[model samples]
Target: MQPINLAAKLALIHEHWMPKVVAEMNDYQFKLVKLRGEFVWHSHADTDETFIVVQGRLRIELRDGAIELGPGEMTVIPKGVEHKPCAPDEAQVMLIEPRGVLNTGDQGGARSAPNDVWI
Candidate 1:
């Protein structure tokens, strides 16, 4: 297998809301994405999701409250917790989740993206 340069891998994705898989180890996948505006309100009934900000800022809006994450910060949205992710401006993020997780969570819609794409 060719060595993967994470920086180069991340540079390949230019669209917002589309997460591209960079690497996978065990049952987890590492993803890189550029995000802006608001994402769907949803929840993962069986799995938790982790978000790590690589650049700019992000907000995870939950039913009870909201959490803001800046560069170098991270948060884990627990299983079954309803939440919506939003960013006023473009933000670069890395996500670590179970291999088959749908980015849209349980509330599937137009923004739901196919999983298992390897870069």
Candidate 2:
């Protein structure tokens, strides 16, 4: 297979909070989202969510505390654990999760991103 250029794929995205699928392995999907401001608090009852920061900074907030990440860093929020992702500015993030999991999880609403979408 040919290589996938993250920056090039990311450039094609124009909207924030929208994750475009780039690759998949078995039942897992790899996605890219441009995060700005703060996301709603939510939790996936069936699966965990992984956030890998490729550029800029990211802060994942939980009820007790928050975990901050930057370029080349990542963190996993366990299933059923409520969390909110925030970015003071735009941040490029890679998400790894099951194929059908919703971005907004149990709190799906206007902020929900479509599932199984590709770049």
Candidate 3:
């Protein structure tokens, strides 16, 4: 195994909502994504999703409330809970979830990204 540089990998990403896999453990993956604006409302039916803000700010809008996160902060959205992610400006984030878990979750359309793209 080799060490993965977060910033170095992030520099390779140029699009929002598209997550690039950097590493994997067991059946889970560590992904990096750049986010801005609002994402569609959706939920994973079987697994929880973790969001860690690497830079800038982000907001996870839930049906009942919203959670705001900044650099070095993170939140876990439980399975089956509908939520949308938003970033007023550009935000660099990391996601930890099981392999094959869709970035768009239950909601799929033009905004859905490829399931597992490695950098």
Candidate 4:
């Protein structure tokens, strides 16, 4: 199989908060998303969501506190826990979750991006 170039894949993404699928492993999917400003407070009821920062800074705001990540850093938000993701400027990020996981989690709204979109 050919290697997936992250920078090239990410370069094709111009919209913020839209997660585009890059690859899949079993029932899981790897997604690339650009983050800026704030995201709605949400959580997944049935699965955890993992965020891996590829460029810039990302802040995962939890009820208790917040976790900041930079390039090559990552964190997993446990299932059913409310959290908001934010960034002061544009941040390149990757999300790993179940194949059908919603970008906005359980709070479907105007910000929800369609699931399983590939770049």
Q: What lDDT tens digits, residue by residue, belong to model 1 across residues 36-75?
A: 9999999999999999998889999999999999999999
List per-candidate RMSD values in Å.
Answer: 1.5, 0.7, 0.6, 0.6
Between candidates 1 and 4, name the one with more favorable lDDT. Answer: 4
Clashes of each: 0, 0, 0, 0
Q: Please, what is the whole-model Cα lDDT of each candidate in the order they appear?
A: 0.90, 0.94, 0.95, 0.96
Q: Which is superior by lDDT, 2 or 3?
A: 3
Candidate 3: TM-score?
Answer: 0.98
Candidate order, lDDT descending = 4, 3, 2, 1
Give one digit per residue, the lDDT tens place, for model 4 in 1-119: 57999999999999999999999999999999999999999999999999999999999999999999999999999999999999999999999999999988899999999889998
**Quality of model 2 by C-alpha lDDT:** 0.94
Q: What is the TM-score of each candidate against the true structure?
A: 0.93, 0.97, 0.98, 0.98
Q: Give the better candidate number (2 or 4) by lDDT.
A: 4
The regions of model 1 sitting more than 4 angstroms off are 1-5
Which of candidates 1 and 3 reaches a greater lDDT?
3
Best by lDDT: 4
TM-score of 2: 0.97
Q: How many backbone clashes does candidate 2 have?
A: 0
> Once model 3 is optimally superposed onto the true structure by TM-score, how far is the C-alpha of residue 25 displaced, in angstroms?
0.3
